[model samples]
Target: MTSISQTTRPAYSAASPRSDGLSTGFYKLLFMTPTILVLALVVAGPLLYSFWLSLHEYIITYGMGDLVWFENYAVMMSDEFAGVSWVTMKLTVIVVVLEFLIAFGLALLLNQSWLKFREIYLLVLMLPILMTPVAVALMFRLMFNPNLGIINWLLSLVGIPQQGWFGDPDLALATVVFVDIWNETSLMLIMLYAGLKSLPQDPVEAARIDGASAFQILWHVTLPMLKPVILVTLLIRMITALKSYDLIYMLTQGGPGKVTETISFYAYRLGFRFLDIGQAAAVSFILLAAVVVLTVVLLRIMREN
Candidate 1:
């Protein structure tokens, strides 16, 4: 019986990896060739072309001019660039801070074991996120109009004076930040709440058994454990805030003497509105570099913690 079983078993081959006419590694490379080609054509091609364009003085009316090396990058030293950079940084900081606070508060509240109607509350909070950013901006624009806006009427009923929201230089950025907070806080809330839910209960339970207060446990134990998730969430929101353009376009259009203009809007103005494609491309690359640097910094902090 043993001899018959040995005869039935197939013999081992040293070249089994290439028995099908192609080695395993070669087959993987062959299969992946199409994806590599597609990525090169669709992604790398345009990226390299844009970098090339940034090296020249390209105006739509004058066509592509002689290569000027980093001359287009000199825009970074201009006063307008300084102003827009300040605005972008200000907006990014304000929105990120406010949104994080609001979201963290709501996440803590919703994470309570005794909370009722949690799903309904989550659904209501998530409604704003369901709306497109463009639609949100347009709706807010109509609602906050100085003249025929319902927001002004509502404020008048409460004895507050009607104020220009998107049109006022002082209030335009603030109004945009409010709209952003309303639209984005839900996303942060969900992220934080998920992190909270995923945390192991042992530390929390042990803290409680050791007579630790709720706030102490949260500050010392829960928050330390949740740091990675918090960092990732903040990084994502910060990057998107840095790239803010659609909301600015729909609501303020960087109006009231460019008080609301961000780097992204500045780039758009340079390229399409002002016809300086080279400078626009240069600005875009600068923004890309800033994002990369910010990502690296955040990732290092995450790793350290």
Candidate 2:
């Protein structure tokens, strides 16, 4: 009778502890709780707070003013903000395109097996990327100075007129654009180089055997294979370029008549310097929205391509 009763019992209930699943689930929640809390505290909370602040006219001296919903956003969409937005976009595009072109060329050159001491060359080239943005910007600032600059000195050696790089409003933004290209090209090069090295040789060999020209092979085979890497590289560079502040601040401080004033620096000026916290927060959220929109557009294009 006892044996019969034991055989009739459910297998899972007889074998396993009831608390096993519950305990495992509890432990998982416990481990993940800290991360959840930190993310809420740092990211979500602040974003919400900024939005709340943006809806009100909160100045530093006077506390939170009347809830003037969307007034700040309205002001931000004016012609003044539009000009800054255009400048920011222009800088991003110019810097990203130049970096891509230069980096792509360098990547191809480095990928060649005939190059001697290639590792040393790569290491030397990578030195710029190792430095902090502020430090790099400061270094370039000295080099771009018209009077004491090595750049002007070199120009003078070649009998060319010494150009005012950062001092001239026309050249100031473009100079820093070039500065960004120089500083960030190495990252693109490394990423593309790794992608090139990792590509399967079969398709390339087959293309060659089929008598495809070098350009044809690169255009059809290598580039198609490298699409993912290229997309990733473009995405990263665009985001970095969009939020460019440290280098700009260090080099020109958005001087020479506010021609180089990007939206990030403009926002900082609006809030911290001018003490219009509400409007500054509004500008920030607008910038954030713009970034998100651009990123989404980029992602969509990449996916479609």
Candidate 3:
């Protein structure tokens, strides 16, 4: 009877903790594999191909030619390259600074609890964001037309002389800047407004209790807390402004003596118009490098703050 009881006893084996952890980790990786493969295929593939094209003296009509190494990159030393770089930097700085100021002011106004019809104001402000960039550019082009545009007509009503907004070399860049501000300020406003909404109320309440003026509180308390968001917003906007192409294409086409030409437009003009793919790719890579360096610096600043 004792031997039979021992033989029929149930097994009591338990999985080790290490084995459980390994299995859990394996499952997690199994689920993530598809996403990793997709990113490599979509993002990494095109980047590598572009870099490869930049190293060669390839023309679209003549097919891929000799591998010319860094000769294409030598275009950076050219006067035309310098001109476009200056235009790009100027546009980016102007648009970013103006937009941030406008957006921050609007965000503050909209965040006020006593503001009436706040939703209506928000909807009106967001109207530009809903419109496609192409549509905005085209509309602005029509409105700013020297003779037939409403803008010139309205100025005439106010006893002001007609201005060559886009046709005049002196005014073309400023006109482009205006259009950019009109279109892009809304996005900046939304970002800042969202940041304001998410800010903790405790610090602000404490400041009120201490009898701090509104401007004082904004400068001393709010700005420091909002620095990270502001930096991130500026970084995103700067990168975008650096890559601006569609507006120039639709409105100016880099005309008026290249006054509004940006690095992106320059690259497009080379690759498409001039058919110098290698040089164009080099220009694009240089812009990419600038954006990457700017991003790294801004990220570091954020971490430090």
TM-score of each: 0.91, 0.89, 0.89
lDDT of each: 0.91, 0.87, 0.90
| Model 2, span 1-305: residue lDDT tens | 97887777654343344545454446668899999999999999999999999999988788789999999999675887987888888888988999999998888889876999999989988888888999899889899889998999998988999889998988898899888987888998888899899999999999999999989999999999999889888888888888879987888877787878889988888888888989989998888987898789788877886
lDDT of 1 by residue, 138-251 (tens): 999999999999999999999999999998999999999999998888888899999999999999999999999999999999999999999989998999899878999998
Better of 1 and 3 by lDDT: 1
- Candidate 3 lDDT by residue in tens digits, 68-172: 999999999999999999999999999999999999999999999799999999999988987888999999989999889999999999999999998899999
* Models ranked on lDDT: 1, 3, 2
User: On a 0 to 1 TM-score scale, where does candidate 2 land against the true structure?
Assistant: 0.89
RMSD of each: 5.7, 6.6, 8.3
Clash counts for the predictions, in order: 0, 0, 0
The TM-score leader among the candidates is 1
